[model samples]
Target: MRDPAANNGRELARSPREPPSVNCRLEGDPTPMQVAKRYRDATPESDRLPAKKARLLSTNTQQLGTENETQTKKTTLQQPEPRRSKRSYASFLDDFADEALVHRRPELLCTFVSEWLESVESDREKHCRSDSHLHPSDEQPVARLRTRSAPVMVKARDIGGFTVPPTPSSTGPPSFRADLDDDRSRSSSSSTANVRNPRYRQNNLRFNCIHVRHATSPLPVTLSGHVDSLRAQRSSPGLSSDDLNQAMYRIDVLAEGCDEEQVVKLLDDTVFPDPEGDDTFGPATGLMSNSSTLMAQHLVPADGASPYRVTQPKPDRLYGYSERTVGGAFTQSQLLAQTMLHDRNPDYTTATSRGLRFPFLAIQFKAVGGTRGDLWVAANQCAAASSACLNAVHQLNISLQACQSTRRVDNLSYCIAVDNKLAELYISWREDSSNYYLQQVDTFVLSRPVEFQSFRTQVRNILDWGKDARLTQIGDALDVILEENRKNAAQAAKSRTSPPDDPAASAKRQKPSSRRNSKGSQSSQTQICATNPTLPEAEAG
Candidate 1:
């Protein structure tokens, strides 16, 4: 040995590092020895890393191929094709290795990369050309300049229609190193870029029909019966008009002004008294000064206070006790129809959208049909005075109850009848508070009728027929029709002015008439002017 380390160092210093030796540059059909020598001289240490990586990748590929084969056999549909073979792992690495050699040798690199790029572009173009899922015409790049992060959260969803939660403002988007994250979001966004897809039109059409009806039309309705009392366990004998006033019920006859001694004397004479004292009602004051503060208010047998049911033996003239009063209770409701909303700024669909709210709560008189106006004063009064609660919710329950009574309309888009048999007297609230709200109530169901449908159809037809429809489709159709009409009118005017004695021109002219149907065939409504076949043949004549 001749001091090897020192000799190697001297050799390295002598070469001036030769730009790290363009690693393993392939010569024209170079032999293995030449290639190996090139690799070694290119720098032994640098070669070790790539060699190790190559071994690892090769081992992984072999293992992946084996497992894939096993899986292919295990799967039925008699077995899936092995993915690793399809992947062409060895071939892929071969290309990469070839490219590295080319880079070092210049001449080879250009040819290999060009071939690879061509294959990639061809595959990509094929995919792009076949795929209609994306709307390139509408696929304008998203304006990244806008930020709606702080907008109020209404509702949003992914392409699958599943709801996604809003992201936190503080956490921010993913880290810079997150490579797949950007691609994932981009893919998700691209999939939904076609905002005018037919699905959008369908969804908008539904909302259009529903919202417009609710906003413009009235709802269906029904009322619950008073027969609930008959089936109820508790027996409330029901109230008379006077019983409705709770104020007058608890009063007792007494002196003008109440004093302390008078109150004591009344308590002693009347209700809860000493064993030796009398019970009575009299002027009260002092401790009993509170309006409801009567002491031991006495009760007598109640012939005077109880509702006089003369039937079953209250032979004695009883007085001084009271019974709780009973009042009636019931429910009522209204159901609004669905409708399309208006659109000043056109949306993705032909139909517009608007939300229907509560309808005009008016009074209808069954006996006097036209008398009831769309006023709320009388209805509100009835709503208040009737046993039924006057809230929209309570009214809804009443309508449901009323619906249960019959089987005519089940979907309940918009309808209701107010034929509550037990309803003693119905009153509707007045819309105007300036006047007293005392109007008789009638049964009126506020739903869109057939005429309403015809109106909507006519509007849609007009939109389709006229250029003023402001839609591309409708405008084109209109232009064609107008052009044809103008031509026809001009020809008709020319025919009227033609010289009367022009025999040839007259002979050439044809009269227009309605079309005729042939045997077992439907006739076309329109007809072209043609000469009659019934005319005598010139030679025969």
Candidate 2:
């Protein structure tokens, strides 16, 4: 029933006898749907870039960040590198662009850009000092390089520039690869995430970026200060500050084909350019440790701005603070600080809340007189104390400064601490009624009024004394005796029972000898002769 003409046309299309132009419409000049499908397929591969680049760009000095990198998700971080006093970014980029164009590393070239015109994009205080070593995959084709982080200001010269060459490689270090083959495994963008144990190896890294721009018109005092503080410093191990110097040389080349107005236009075009924009420069990240540190420098009262949200942590766990007191600080930086604060439960008073009964850390203040017991003077009186016989002096002090309290008497303070590497345990406890103790219920609570002295020592001692406090020694709590009692009940019941004896054996067969039997009824015995041949009369005494 089909038309011959239609059949012939379909056959022609499949047979490869069709014209090339028709084929182009079907495949080459893709429809939006086809383009979208390709993009979907390409994304996994796209995510691979950061993983490879992160491993690639990191020096031994930068490697310490690797431990945290895997646990975090992609986010933008603001990195406002101090700009050099006499440097011109416009001139520098123009020159850098010409060289990259010559070399043709389009991927890197396109990403290096200034999107400042589009508000650029809402895009490291040190603790310890140590040499950093970047670990590579054990499966290799390379060498190792050792490096360390040091602070320095890069100087931007006041001149036209030339091309800067790539610094020699610093690939010597240890061996470390994310266990997950796909480094981009953590693509989920959730507000909260469990902080990874530092020992875990993560392939996924949080990618953060930001851009900076300044006017070419005239130099201002504030801008000068910014530039002077932003330059790269020289290191003896790998690259030198001169490499940044050479970046200026490339700027001269950027100025070659263009005039001042054109340079301005280029800078303007660079702002928020499409994905394919020029790539000599970009919003650099990991240029500093994290976004919060950057924000504190920019938004904190001293950083010269009315308070703003510019530097807040990305809405994810890897870069967050646990305590509201620590506020929006990065979780890593706040770990130690957070550890020092009072936990959700200061005591086992609320058996239901975590940390209640979980071991605490005690810091007994020695300054207050022993008799006054530290908190007495602070609270101003003894009878005024809240709990009877409660030497309980709960205070809230950070760095030993007394936190104000409405409590008129002995207000003691307490805090917990953790290991220095931002490694910590958020100890929480749950009362298990199914087993023994009442689950946050009224039963089993000691009859005595709550006492604070024993209380203060209790939690701190648990953590301090550790498992020893929790260990069940013989006859400790009555519950152990009760368990033993149950088992004994079954054993006692079995031992007390006995079986009845059988009556049938030989006695029933001997019934015929009745007359000769020595026994007789009580009346016959009284008569003394009926049942037996002779018997003495039984007399009542």
The digit string of per-residue lDDT tens for model 2 on 13-38 reads 64221111111233224422233345
Overall local distance difference test of candidate 2: 0.26
Most lDDT-accurate candidate:
1
lDDT of 1 by residue, 1-541 (tens): 2354564454347322122122343333343223445665787665567776787689899999999998987774442345764222234343345433543556444554455455554444443333544423346433335676767768777776667798665564467536567778755654332222334222322221211112223322331121121123322122233432221221122223333333333322221122112121111100001111111101001123322111111100111111111210001100101011111311111110121111111111111112222223222222222111112212232333333422111111111112111011232221221111222222221122322222223222221221111122222332333444456679899889984587766655532222223421332211211244454556223
lDDT of 2 at 301: 12
lDDT of 2 at 226: 28
Of candidate 1, the 10-residue stretch with the lowest lDDT total is: 328-337
Q: What TM-score does each of the candidates earn?
A: 0.15, 0.15
